[model samples]
Target chain A: MASVNRPNKQQNHPLDDLIRKDRIPHIWCPGCGIGTIFASCLTAIKECVATGKNGFDLDKFVMVSGIGCSGRAAGYVKLDSFHTTHGRAIPFATGLKLANRDLNVIVFSGDGDLFAIGGNHFIHAARRNINITVICVNNLNYGMTGGQVAATTPYNAKTTTTPAGNAENPFSLPLLAYASGATYVARWTMLHTRDLTVSINEALSKKGFSFIEVLSPCPVNYGRRNKEKPLETLKLYQEKSIIKNGADPSELDIDMEKGIILGKFVDIDKPTHSEKYDKLYRIE
Target chain B: MTENTTESRVLTGEHFMTGDIACAEGALAAGCRFFGGYPITPATEIAEQISLRLPRVGGTFIQMEDEIAALTSVLGASWAGLKSMTATSGPGFSLMMEAIGLGLCTETPCVIVNVQRAGPSTGLPTQGAQADMMQARWGSHGDYEIIVLAPSSPQEIFYQTITAFNLSETFRLPVIIMTDEIVGHMSEKVIIPEAGKIETVNRLRPKGRKDRFKLFEPDPNGVALMPAAGDGYKIHVTGLTHDEKGYPVMTVEAQAEMMARLTGKIRNNIDRIIQTEELFLDDAEIVFISYGVSSRTCLEAMAMARSKGIRAGFLRLITIWPFPDDQIRALAKRVKALITVEINLGQIHREVKRCAEGKAPAYLVGHPGGTVIPPERVLAMAEEVL
Candidate 1:
């Protein structure tokens, strides 16, 4: 099996081997937090597998992504990956996990890719309790598409499409996921690097639909339009973020002014899609 | 678990069954273990039959959220090392177009059953139509070749469904079984052969070390072997145009290389893929060309014309796409007229006309398609020459 843990000190960075570094100096802007969030995910996977905390099989690990800035993550990862169509990653990954139980399938995508166009698939997969990990980067706007207002864009935030102000209310991702029956759900900002990484590891280790929503910085598009600089937003997250584990998901809707509620909101045991399916169809 | 004799899963002996039920039995006989589908009007019985029979045969059936997800899940199951399929009608088949293109681009092998019904947009739900014939050929938004089979009766559909699976596995493409509502819902006697008697083809599995397996590198036959998710090959499958390594190359050369193989595999093997049935064309003055439910009407019309001392012949298409143009060209030279009978306005009739290409006076007997084209209409066309 291919090992994902070995540190290559000569490469200037430990994750250089896990990354398609030739495609480096990536398309993401300098202040964009996609790189950091991606790095944290790699670290989480490496730690979970290498430390033997989980008997994860690297060979059977597959990463799937939809079209967007974040969709490019699949092409960079040096494992079995699928860069599927726009807004269809969840359904595709759901199929992959259900088709083969041994595969540790993970869907890595963006806010517009998930909550906007892919909302139906998201609700359905969670409803079925599929065993797959979903990491959504909420940059508050469609950064790659010239900063259109997204489903998670806070009310009154300015975007290219919503220059006056976003009149639409944002969806509380945790509440939506929890209500849809996700077995594990959490929220964290990109500034909480270590905590976000740990949450990714936890979601990976869980046996049902697990979702982690990461608040990321999109300086070039989102930040410039919204008047919040990248570094300033990180500092704001540090000051205003409150860790409240086991809080009611309904109460954790992100409020840019009051504060951001961050922590694991839901984690409960449930027989996953394949578990119940296999048990019912057991060929004895 | 019981040892996979690959025998008892097959249902044998003769029985009275609908086209939908025979279709399901054909898939089970072909060693298909995964089915993902939605419930649509005429095609719903296919999902119903497969749902009940698949569990008994140790197979999996998933009723996805929608038709898009239905075909999408089947593609996923195919990559996970299962012979998978999905069934839908016109509206549902339209919803699956994007994934069909994805399946074509990725060269994923699976079967799709479109029990075609009337529709420009859900025109008639419970009735029959051959309107989707052209859509089945050029439905998805790209340039590529496809393999489609249209079965005329329940017995023929049983055999055609198995052949659809075999060809899909052999060529690494989605094979379409385009049976219409008339053939789909009608009851008839279908004889299923024993497992030992039936021949099924499985996809080529890569051998030697997993590290050496380049996922899209073709064999001499122009088809590459496949590796499942856990095969240690660690292949990357993307919908983007890709190179031989199965990685997105995003270059013109990569697309040309990929498209060349994708379109070439079936084209080069056209001699084997296109199947047709010719009846009494040896000394005929005019030929009536048809397929699916329409072909049955042509058979009756040909006999009616011959009884009137008119020399009329019938050419039935079993495989429509990668069309039997060569046969039509050959017959066009000898026949005085070539007439096509179809339920659709002029879907396959257009193909027949293009292939005939003025060598003969090409004509059509067509309808908007709520029911099968009657033999009386075909006989009327045949009487013109007599």
Candidate 2:
């Protein structure tokens, strides 16, 4: 109450230059973790741009996202962003990157967007080792559609569509990425911001399909039905997640009762799709 | 391997080529450097020929997982400042409808070639049919105008494909080349002009301050100058109803404005977009309206009707969309009757009847589309109408 009538001041965020200021006061709910994950992505991009490592040009950074709550990330970013049709972001980004090899394309989408309807594109892109960074925000449910059961919804989790508790098992994203031949695969939670940012930065420097699964909270949709608050989710992430670097991808499934294996699971070199195309098709 | 030269790129001489191969060469000559496609019957040859030729001419060809990916990739490549194309049949064309709507909403310039096959869900895959004509007009679930060119022969497909790329660039939307299985596989003499002799129109690039540029801001022609991804425009493009700045604005007024920009471009420029070929319509009493492979049959029918003293005129629709309403209305005012000939069962006939507005009696001479409608059936329809 001391300075309730004090003059309002305009404060700028550090990542304001990278954001579309007019589009803010974003659609993300209060306890949602997408904002933090998005911040980490911008931070990774900033770091890559500053270091000029791996030919990361700010002008050449294009953000592509599919339909979901997180798909709106493409609209919020000031970079050349495309909010493509649902489940087609990877193929769209594939076209953009393959058309102009100079551009650095990153697809930022949600778990429902990346793994559910877009699963085929995800696996094929990883198989081809396309040079792109895909950061999937795993929010465990279809938060945009009011907490419906998603492909990544935890087993026995109560959702709008699965109010009796889900009977389906969730996808182990890192395991899928590894099995699909992703050159770089990692998993981290929003609570692990430093590790997530570093992993994203490392993925950006790599030259093949790099996938990083970021477990984010959809407290309003997921936590309320699961009888867990945002703080409780964060606590579980802190206490139950084990930072096991280079762990076997098969052992990286998320189990709230057990432990979530978090860290880089796969990192190997292979010729990217473009490199192979050039080698086979382009003769000087 | 053929030498990649300006000559090789244009293939600047007359050659006997299939419609699919000629279409691919036309794309190459029109500066289409990226093709994203999936193999479907009757259209697979386009993909095959492009895959073999595109790489040699410094182009990229990707066989996508499905038609959805194929068309979406084409849209993405187009936004990256490449003239992109995709070829598909009825099944694949159906799969591409949603992406076509996306392409319209985002004002992306690309070419979609639909080599028609009979279909109501895989009806006839290997045979030729013109059943998808109506689908081509109203395939995508939206209130947007589209440019569709119906090329009847291998040579016509070659020239029309180049025109398709030009029109797409000029209007900044996906232009469709609606050739059927008959024309797609038919081999004929296609004249390939030298690269310099061919006129290719490129999308206008934004000039002046990059920061001040709005992505969806239309010029006098209702088309905005486009900038590529790495051009530092920092543009945001979405399928949502967007403002001139390409930012999604969820309001009725925003929807109205965006719709105007999307639909106005084609409506205002209909004169330039609509192309038709007329034969002996000056003083004829009866007229026959047709397009694509069916137009070839209509021509033969008109000649037969003329021999029988029926005074039948032929009107071939080269540009099917925008419907040539003005020409139809005027012809309806003068003619006694209009006979619509197509392989499909009375699709364009309905459009002709609507435009005729009961001024002239419109009858359809159509088949169920397993095979082409013979000229005798069309001539019989004309005599019965008379």
Candidate 1: interface RMSD in Å?
1.6
Candidate 1 colliding pairs: none
Q: List lDDT for all candidates, in order.
A: 0.87, 0.92
- Summarize candidate 1's per-residue lDDT along B1-386 as a digit string, tens digits: 12123236777787788898889889998988889889998999888877777766777788888888888878888888889999999999999998899899889999999998898788899999998988899999889999999999999989999999999999999999999899999999988887899999999988898766788888888899998877777778888888887778778888788889999998899998999999999999989999999998998888888998889999999999999988999999999998999998888888888988979888999998898777888889877754
Candidate 2 lDDT over residue span A204-227, tens digit each: 999899999999989999999999
For candidate 2, give the lDDT of residue B67.
93
lDDT tens string, model 2, B1-386? Answer: 23223336888887888898889888998999999999999999999888877887788999888899899999989988999999999999999998999999999999999999887889888778888877887888878889999999999998999999999999999999999888999898888887899999999998789989999999999999999999999999999899999999999999999999999999999998999999999978999999999998988998999999999999999999979998999999999999998888888899999999869998998888778888998888887878
Candidate 2 deviant stretches above 4 angstroms: A1-10, B1-7
Clashing residue pairs in candidate 2 are none
Computed on C-alphas against the true complex, the DockQ of each candidate is: 0.59, 0.82
lDDT of candidate 2? 0.92
